[model samples]
Every structure is written in C-alpha cells, then in structure tokens.
Target: MVEAATIGYTSFPGYPEPPYALVYARPDRADTAIGNFLHGLDLADYHVALERMHIGARVSAVFAAERSALVTDFHWVLDD
Candidate 1:
C-alpha cells in the first residue's frame, strides 16, 4: 500500500478540501491476491480534528489491466 497526504491547500473540482490521506495498493500478482482486503477505511471524523493521526479510511480502486495501474476511488462518509 502507498500512502500520501496533502501538503498544502489543495482542492479538486468536486472533491473535499486539503488534508486528505490517500491510500492505494499496488501488489505484485504473485505476492498478493485481489479481494476485499484491499479496501480501506473511513476516518474522516478523526482526520478533520487531528493533525497527526493514523491513516484509516475507506478506499476503493479500479485496476487497469492494460496499464497495470490502480485508479483511486474516493468516498466521503460521516461517522456516528
């Protein structure tokens, strides 16, 4: 898994504001299998309030067999 965080005030056209923990997986076909284990978690509640917190968020990816790349899928949720 590759983890990244926003460095500055960044914004996408339809996405949330800065301060996002982006996580994705790029496993070798021989080492890792494809399954729900690759999915991430949802920690928006903690992320918004804490500056240095653990990386946990619900994530999904669209694999491109042609290019062998993981396309990041993002979703926002409010925890109760």
Candidate 2:
C-alpha cells in the first residue's frame, strides 16, 4: 500500500490548473514515489479538500490502459 500526502499544485502549464498529491512507498520514506493528479470543477475547493486530507492516508492508484502507463485515477483506499 502507498501512503498519501497532499503536495499542492503541479508545475505543468495550463489554464484550469491541476493539483497533486504525493504518494510514498512507506510512511517513514522522505522521497515521493509518484504524484496523483487531482481534477474537479472548482480547483480552489478541490485544493482545500486535498489539504485537509491527513498525511500518510492510504490511497490507491489506477493506471491508464495505453503504453504510457500514466495514472488515470486516484482515490482513498476503501474497506470491503
């Protein structure tokens, strides 16, 4: 499982800017393994929600089907 942390906005240039959350392989790890791109109708509210998320929260990543293997989805790990 990956530990999630809200890392703020991405550097990619765009109009409706996208925010990001960093995912760590472990809670004690300092380096980020990957960044999850967040999208919403209102970026401001989305960012606020992201900031409120507790650090080290459990999150899951979904990858695209294409060869690029880019992350296409992200969400909190849910119990069955």
Candidate 3:
C-alpha cells in the first residue's frame, strides 16, 4: 500500500512562517518498487513544489522513507 500527503501552514506558536511538507509512504522500498518510483527526486524538487504552492518554506519539509511498522498505536481502534 502507499500513502502520500501534503500539508500547509497554521499560526500556532513555534510554527514557521509557512509550515509546509510533503511525504510519501509505501510498504516497500525495493529497487523495483517505491525506491525506483521516487528515484531522481531531490531537495530542489521539494523546494520547487512548495514554492509553486506558495507555501514559503520557513520550516523545512521532511523527505524520507522506511519500512512500515509491524504494530501501530492505533491498533485498538481496529480491534473492534
């Protein structure tokens, strides 16, 4: 499975001028999987995308990928 998200800013304390971010999550990062899918993307691309959205990156975006967790804190919600 895959999940992608992008978020914009708010005026809460400690938040930056325009807090923005983009993230991609997948169950696999193999060479022929999500890793290849995300290949060639870089920091500049992130900055450019944010700029196009007028998000103004006073706070930085986090671009990363890792294996999915075996357990989640919200498991209880699914138990019913």
Candidate 4:
C-alpha cells in the first residue's frame, strides 16, 4: 500500500482542500530499499509520478531513517 501524509496545506479556488506531497514506501515502510529507489528522484519525477495517477500532489519533503530501517515518514498531498 502507499503511505500518504501531509503536515500543512494551502487551498485553491476550485479544489476541496490544500495542496500536499506524496511518499512511496516499500515493505510496509520507508526502508533502505524504498529510500534507495527514491534517492535519485527529483521534484520533476515526483510530480510526474503523481500526475500519471491524476493526482495534483506536490512533494514537500522526504524523511528517511538512516539508523533505523523500520523508521521512516512520507509527506504528501492528494487531490481528493
């Protein structure tokens, strides 16, 4: 499953809520494999991925756990 989250948001004229970002976790969390997969990804990549799914999402930030593979957080926003 995809772990989607957001801390703050901004509303648009025709939108229902605020804008946010997205996180792609793997093996149930944001582990080394997941981090590695997203390591080289840029803002464009993130936007493209979200857009392909028809989501008006923007990645605010990506938090990774360097010491613990079991600890990770993904910040994102959704259109609906």
**TM-score to native of every candidate shown:** 0.27, 0.40, 0.25, 0.23
For model 3, the run of ten residues with the poorest summed lDDT: 71-80
Best by lDDT: 2
Clashing pairs in 1: 41-57, 41-58, 42-58
Best by TM-score: 2
Model 1: weakest 10-residue lDDT segment is 71-80
The sequence of per-residue lDDT tens digits that candidate 3 reaches over residues 7-75 is 445565643344434333333333321211222122246566534333221222223454354322111
Task: State, as a TM-score between 0 and 1, how close model 1 is to the true structure.
Answer: 0.27
After superposition, the stretches of candidate 2 with alpha carbons farther than 4 Å from their true spots are 1-4, 7-11, 14-16, 20-22, 25-33, 38-43, 46-48, 69-80
Query: Could you give candidate 4's per-residue lDDT for residues 1-80 as a string of tens digits?
Result: 23442222466564333333334433333453222112222234545644442322222334555435432343232222
Give the per-residue lDDT digits (tens) of candidate 1, residues 38-78.
22233355555333322343234444446623323322221
Cα-based lDDT for every prediction: 0.34, 0.44, 0.31, 0.35
Ranking by lDDT: 2, 4, 1, 3
lDDT value, residue 40 of candidate 3? 19
**In candidate 1, residue 60 scores what lDDT?**
41
Model 4 scores a TM of 0.23
